[model samples]
Target: MHLSIPPGNMKGTMEGEASPELKLEGDIPARYVMPQQDRPSAAAGVAPIPVVDLGRLSRPDADGGAVEEEAKLRWALETWGFFMITNHGIEASLMDAMMNASKEFFGQPTEEKQKYNNIIDGKRFRLEGYRSELLQSEGQTLDWSCRLSLQVEPEGERSFHLWPKYPKSLRDVLLQYASRTKIIKDCIMRALANLLELDEDYFINRTTTRARALARLGYYPPCPRPDLVLGFKPHYDGGALSILFIEENVGGLQVLRNGKWYNVLAKPCTLLINIAECIEIMSNGIFKSPPHRVLTNAEKERTSVAIFYGVDVETVVEPAPGLLDEKRLARFKKIKAEDYYGTVFEHFRQGKRLIDTLII
Candidate 1:
């Protein structure tokens, strides 16, 4: 309820002044120009989106428990649809003070960063908006970069009643890093229901049942023309799982498949695990939801945060009656998580084609 953006919508359309301090290099210029739908054409290779590490799942030394973290969290989510968490214990100075409070709230002054402007039922959180080339069709471009989206969740009522206001020492270091990222998102959903073998209190009581975390933060900036523009376009993560945290030697994140774009090689304190589409429809789809993107930089500037972790807009997500009783077929069809979030944002506001209209 504490919003404040005046100063005449703090002018923007790139005038002059400001826009400095960005110097992390290795071959800058947004890493070799790119933007033909984030050009991937090498048959998008690199294992869909796998990474898993979570400090080799080892919970038990305080007195020996949970059998070697349930066999390395079930062989790293059955061979990764993405993973790389570490120790499942967060606090690298609360992820460097939540990445230095997301570059000090996107470097303030855009009218005090649009006084936490998020609209939700009206949808208006733009934060540097730009993505309308007939919505880039297959490339659906529009991600030079700049975010802040918040919405902690029901656990002691997280944040985001409107926008970004966490400044009480960055909201007590992001609520103690969201109370240790809600106990590592309930031990990664009870290690994804014991890696599909189910019955671990069936995902440890669905990790606080009606859950619904959120947190974006991103930044990118520095595209003076990094190959004509684009540092986030591809797509494929409507939400049901996500963690991210990025930045350990600066590397443009990527993840597409059978079409090319694999560079997600970060590794400092770790955390990336994706697997979305409501956890690929509560795991019945056998964990997939790949397709990711983010690649810009004329020289430097690329902060991340992500968070996601879903299951609450009136939760429904079907298909697990014992994986539809020996595959009698029902891969995913009980819908209503608000109509799969209104069909992935009404197909991103009818720019068209986001598919996946619940096909169980």
Candidate 2:
């Protein structure tokens, strides 16, 4: 499928001259600004998201350790739809290099960065390049961030032209990170499948080589009035799962739970893993796709990298047969990944979410 933006509607132009640095002098355009009630709160104390250790789960133990780990995984998925993974096997140095490379790339002059503008070859959903806003409508709220998004898996399909050339070490480091994370994703998918009493490779096998694995590097510039703008809007991911790496010093990510918004604390060398809409459907509503948003900070800039994994576009997604019983019938109808994504893109343009459209 193809998605494009007209030349005249490019980002940062209407508000003023397009530049790398954020324009902090004028009032935020009405469309870019959100209502006061929608602004994030400065609550002093908030509960922290759960953190799970993969290394511990992998080590052999006689105390029914594996069972305990699986239980924890199920609880976190059912309760938070998100969790932070520690000792996930990715090297700390490599993670640092990836973060530094992202910062270096976005730190380049606006002219140089624009060379990799998201609308690759003018109009195609190639899934690799840079973009300030994914949904660019006439009055849609724009995110206060710049993003570099690219597909990193099934290596053969990579578009080297869309990859950045500067920061010499970027391509190498990102490839290394993606390779390692793919392993983690596979391991987690196996555990999730077993948790539902399905074959260990149920998820891994369905995610064909053509499945899209995208990495998004986000840079949120400090805002003059943080309360007036959003770094990102409230939305659920359209993919199967996402692993996020955030700058330890800057905080802005928040997830909605029990009708309250709670801040997601940035922990050093830890990856935050969250379930997405596809997983929710595959799990037959046993797992949730939570709504999350990023708030802007007045003094601190925030940067994050998210790796989104999904099945092939034409693959049919639905509640697994093993997960259904007399009392627990399928809660979601079967649908192709492409159809689901199309619905998501449509709802996104209207400032809505596709989660509500998946109910059986």
Candidate 3:
């Protein structure tokens, strides 16, 4: 459906200039219309998102292969909260087709698109959008994008009820992506289990049984003055983990590290894996849940697809006792996942740093 950026909500109005207050939404536009072919005019460059060749880890024939894979996974997690993965075992054509369908969905006429608005249908919780109704408890400007969400329900529920209607062939693309991603996610979780010295089945079973798989198909329409709007504001994803397939050549993703923002430097065929809030909590502060944001383009529009694997909302979250020694345990405490999430979410609603509230 046709959605517009609120009045005066520009992204980078003060880029490279210094100011204490973040212009959270400066002159946000009143209307946002999706268009095809929206892209950044100039190429922004940086070292790419760190890449891990999973193939090296996948070779069952290699000597000490399992150990090698665990080490790589640990290194990647410790350094960057995000990374690109290769040899993920998903077909290239499938990815291409999914991207195409996502683009088409966002490009549809407003009337047609609005037909699927989750908010309007009273399924606000399950509906995908930049804003979450749960967080409505604290009023914040709605995020500047629209998205569609789907889940593989309990009992391998494959009913169309969970998936949105799209032109023919689009559904196939999404299903394939979801299925393949589950496989890669399983692989990554197993490696994570090894790193934690927990049973391989621990993560696999936790992830799959309570596994919550959802996709956000985003559309950032072209802005007259791109610097004035944000593709997305700086924030951490609230989930167990996330896998993102960003649009090729549409630069916007940036992550904060060492107090400076680093361009994620995305590329086609590279899948970005990001640690969510839950992972950080489980790691007991060893790994970070870095804040990330997307800058609006000065001259073009942008779009992206993100699939998230989250734990069941009702699940209790505490430091995985296995990962914490007495020394580490002393430095941290346990809290239910829902409570911790609410605390962080409240801080963000006031435009404050989410981690600052929970770390202490």
Candidate with top lDDT is: 2
Clashes of each: 12, 0, 19
* Candidate 2 backbone collisions, by pair: none
Choose the strongest candidate by TM-score.
Answer: 2
lDDT by residue for model 2 (38-61), tens: 877777244467777787666647
Off by over 4 Å in 3: 1-48, 60-72, 121-143, 153-159, 338-348, 352-360
Off by over 4 Å in 1: 1-16, 19-109, 112-114, 117-143, 160-195, 209-212, 217-240, 243-253, 256-273, 276-292, 296-307, 310-360
Across 70-166, the per-residue lDDT of candidate 1 in tens digits comes to 5544444444456666666776877888888877776665656545545322343342221112222332334455566555666565543554564
Q: Model 2 scores what on Cα lDDT?
A: 0.77
Candidate 3 per-residue lDDT, tens place, 105-183, comes to: 7666555665655554343343343322232422243444556666543436444754557667767787778888887
Q: Whose TM-score is higher: candidate 2's or candidate 3's?
A: 2
RMSD of each: 19.5, 4.2, 7.3
